[model samples]
Target: MQTALLFPGQGSQYIGMGQDLFTRSIVARRTFEEASEILGYSVSNLCFQGSEADLTRTDYAQPCILTVGIAAFRVLVERMEREPVYLAGHSLGEITALTASGALHFADAVRLVRFRGMLMRDAQKHKAGSMMAVHGLTPQVIEKECLEPEYRGLVVISNLNSSRQTVVSGQVNALTKIKERFTDLGGHVTPLQVDGAFHSPFMKNAAMQLYDELRLIPFHSMRYSVLSNVTALPYPNVNCIPSFLSEQMVERVRWQGCVQFLMERQVYNLIEVGPGSVLSNMLRREKLDACMIQSMDKKEYLQKLIKESLPKGNRAVSYAHYLKAALCAKNYNIHGETSNYLKEVAGPFRELEQLARSGDVADGNAKALEALNHILDCKMTPAIQRGGILSHIAEEGVVRHV
Candidate 1:
């Protein structure tokens, strides 16, 4: 199956999330433990015992939600032997997606988001803005209304969640003034419980601060493609990671576009891996009949996915084997700095090749992709040459299976 994994952002978090997974799975427990050590707070206690108000605080919510999402993903990775073709996240969930894709270490991601949440919370204190969800209105109508003289430069669409659901963020007064206008236009305006006007110009200062933090952190090449909420497309490359992620804070989350991109790429299975069913519900609203949507939140859902293992002789597995052989036969010649090539490219490829031979289709596919990413990151190879190799691998190793 051509599968895509989705991660939920803030507002999807709730107390007691991931408790069952923590109790039932060692991998889940360890993930939470690792995050806690890095964060210097018990994420497990926060999720399983903290009050709703505490969990709702932006400073506390971001890391907590990210930890739970990563815990769930680790549990799934341990139990299921399937590699998703793409990964996407909503708002704060984007960091979770990057972490899962191997672009960021879990420790670095958790610390970065915690700092992000603090900056956003401080921004809210300074500017005092809010957000509201507008339902039953087309984005065009909402955009036009936001452009009205009374609200222009104050209110803007923050999240394009779906065709019928959009979230607006701005100064409190601007949202208040527009709510009545939207109500009169047959749109239901529900105030969101967020602290600040996220994904709007209100977050400009915070985004800049986040950019500095992002620069200090190291980003790795991703094993799987991660869709950027700011662009609603796969991230272009690691060089653009910090800037794109910083821009995501003040730019509208093009979730609807991200979904469209996935569907256009023939993703038939969509799994929401996080604390709540928010993303899954949004996907359902899209009415994609050809897509099979599943959410991994509770223990039962995890069990169900584990039980649905792929049958033997699947095309994905066969393709992975072919990829392994092709990789083995490929030349590793480079123009200069052979040491960097050996360290960054050849060494990782050797390890991934061994993983591909381990008889687990999921591991094999994931390793093959990681190996490809390593090769692409080799600066010794020309960009055009690397692109050609990637194209060849995709055509031979992936296209036929789809």
Candidate 2:
């Protein structure tokens, strides 16, 4: 099966991420250095060793997250040398994925993300807006809740995560009302740690500024498929990418539909090449068949997934799976030998009911494994460090045992 590479966006960043690779991998380290020089700031220092507050700022978070994601990506490609048939990114990550596909230069991509963050952050300077997750409720229900009488004109849908889960954004009071309605409907609701009502009309001003910056930047044709947020379809050219980048802020993040489009195109394997497995989690929920999904944000998970994806002839996949089975041998509770997970990834929890039925998929583990090799390159890991801090914190807080 052909492979697909995915990149995550804004919501994934936290302090002290990409810390291990920054120190361990020379290629990963160079990505940080290049980013720092291009941005005219010590972003690598901030990404590897800055404080939470410092890393969390929009200006800092934008380039910082992108750097780590790209660093992990470079390590993956350099190591695996696997070519993907298509590329996709969520929100801000779209630009990163496009660049990885040879659509844009790395430096131009960084500049765009920097300005993109600045514009989005400035848009809500005076607005006390927020986003809340609505679980077990359809997008229709939550969208209706926002426009009810007192809360009308305040709330709007921001992230269409899946059929069963969505993130709505609006004025504080409107969001509160929506959350209350969700609770009463026996749905789960949680608040997101975001600064503004992103991906909504509230970001119209941000779109304007980004449009100006996008016009100044140059874009090149993509080497592979690039699914866009505005179209919820594959972007065929680079000429229109700049405008789409800005317009996306004022548009809805049709993530669920995006996943559907991927599946329809037979993209069985998916890799999230940035901090956190948030996007992978969403894809897992939406996949009908149990498919291969991996993240390159950390070292452990991606390594495990890539090891799982190799062709039967490729000894690396066999060896890795052998190791996992051998190490976790005590937990299987079976006496006879297994096929080294030859069929599919065995796990519980598909998702919640119909939403899960349509959202979470079931498939063979082969595609999933292959995708890992496409963008992760062997050095990147999926395992998250237990006590690792964000880059800002790692810089100042990590102390030697001595």
Candidate 3:
């Protein structure tokens, strides 16, 4: 199936977000550890045990969310055989998408986002703005209202989440007036848990500072296409990455457009690889019923993917059977020492046979190679004889099956 990966932004974060991925997958654990080492703090601790108040801070939340998104993506890479055709993120998630696409090194991306978060927080202290989600309103109506004489120059639509939902960001007073206006027009308004009016003119200074940070970091060619939140299109070239990323802070997130573009390309499998199901819920709201959507927010979801990706049918069993027969046919005691044969070859082969019978392809395949090593290590077996057995096993697809 053609798949696209979507990463969630700041509001998706919470206490104990990535704890499951951290505990269950070594790749995920290493990703968190690597971020912790680079940031000089335990990202795992923050995601798995930090308080909600601390996690809500832009400086902390941005990095924490980025770490979790990338951790889950890494675990997915380790477990699944298929690769996504496109990648996209909501807000701070765009950075996560970039890191996962290999356009930005994980270490550099971590420090850059921490710096970006600090800049945004500083901007919030200076300007003091907020964001509110306006539901049951079309983008055109919200845009028209923002351009009115009283609300104009005060608030702007910051997020085009869907046909039914839009987010506005601006000064506190302006947002209050806009919220009242929107509510009177039968629109439901809910305040977002954000520090400043992100993706609006209030973040211009932060965006400029972020541009300088982006300049210092080197961006590589992406392994897969990544859609920009600012343009809702695939990045045209590597040179535009820094400018487009910086511009994203001050431009509305065209998430609805991004999803539409994916649908146009016939990409049906949408996987949200992050801390929460916010993106998945958003897609559902868009009413893309024909698409298969999934969220890797918990360990159970990751386990499901792993199970589905396992080799199917009797190929694994057949390989296991062939190996067992070969091992039994081989004489481990060419030197006439039966004790070495019993300890080395017999024990490991028995374990491999049990794994094969259990029908766990991954484990059985792993144990088969390990058992082969044991068989080759028997001191009583002649070196020439061992080579002959190894060649025969290779011919039987032992290595290829794995």
Question: TM-score per candidate, in order?
Answer: 0.77, 0.73, 0.77
Give the local distance difference test score of model 3: 0.78
Q: Rate the local accuracy (lDDT) of all candidates.
A: 0.78, 0.66, 0.78
Q: Per-residue lDDT tens digits of candidate 3, residues 111-158?
A: 998998898889988667889999998888889999999988889999
lDDT of 1: 0.78
* Candidates' RMSD to native: 8.6, 16.9, 12.6
Expressed as tens digits, the lDDT of each residue in 1-402 for candidate 1 is 788899999999888998877876555676788889988889999999999888888999999899989878765653343567899999999999998877787888999999999999999886779899999999999999999999999999999999879999999988998999999999999897678899998888989999999999877667678999999999988778899999999999999999999989899799899898999988888899999999998567876754442223323443354345345544434333456446656676676667656755542254454445445434323223444444445443342110
The worst-scoring run of ten residues by lDDT in candidate 1 lies at: 393-402
Candidate 3: which pairs clash? none
Q: At residue 174, give the lDDT of candidate 3.
A: 87
- What is the Cα-based lDDT of residue 277 in candidate 2? 82
